[model samples]
Target: MEVRHKQATIDKLTHENATLKRLKFAAGREHFNAEQRRLLEDTLDADLQAVAWWC
Candidate 1:
């Protein structure tokens, strides 16, 4: 891929990661339960890993 395209992909994934972090934090506010929060966090982590591998 072109350098510009690669950079854009990286930026987009970074944005997604930030968004997921926000979502996880927002979810944490109400349901402080262990399982739910852990799942959300795990999802976010998987997303981040996928992005990293893709880039």
Candidate 2:
């Protein structure tokens, strides 16, 4: 059903956001610089916003 599909989408987005947060906060990772960190945070925010809209 449409409701179930929307719920699935929201769940997926939530998991993605959580993973991103874990990555962003993990210590000793030299790959991401300050700018990249900001970008990642922005993306996580956007994902959360989309989830909110779905709700």
Candidates' C-alpha lDDT: 0.76, 0.79
Mind sharing the TM-score for model 1?
0.52
- Model 1 agreement with the true structure over 4-53: per-residue lDDT tens digits: 87897778787886877677687757565788768877977887777778
What TM-score would each prediction reach against the true structure? Answer: 0.52, 0.61
**Alpha-carbon RMSD to native, per candidate:** 3.4, 2.6
Worst 10 residues of 1 by lDDT: 24-33
- Which number leads on lDDT? 2
Residue-by-residue lDDT tens digits, candidate 2, 1-55 = 9989888987888698678767957756557779987898798778778777776
Pairs that collide in candidate 1 are none
The numbered model that scores best in TM-score is 2
Off by over 4 Å in 1: 1-15, 21-29
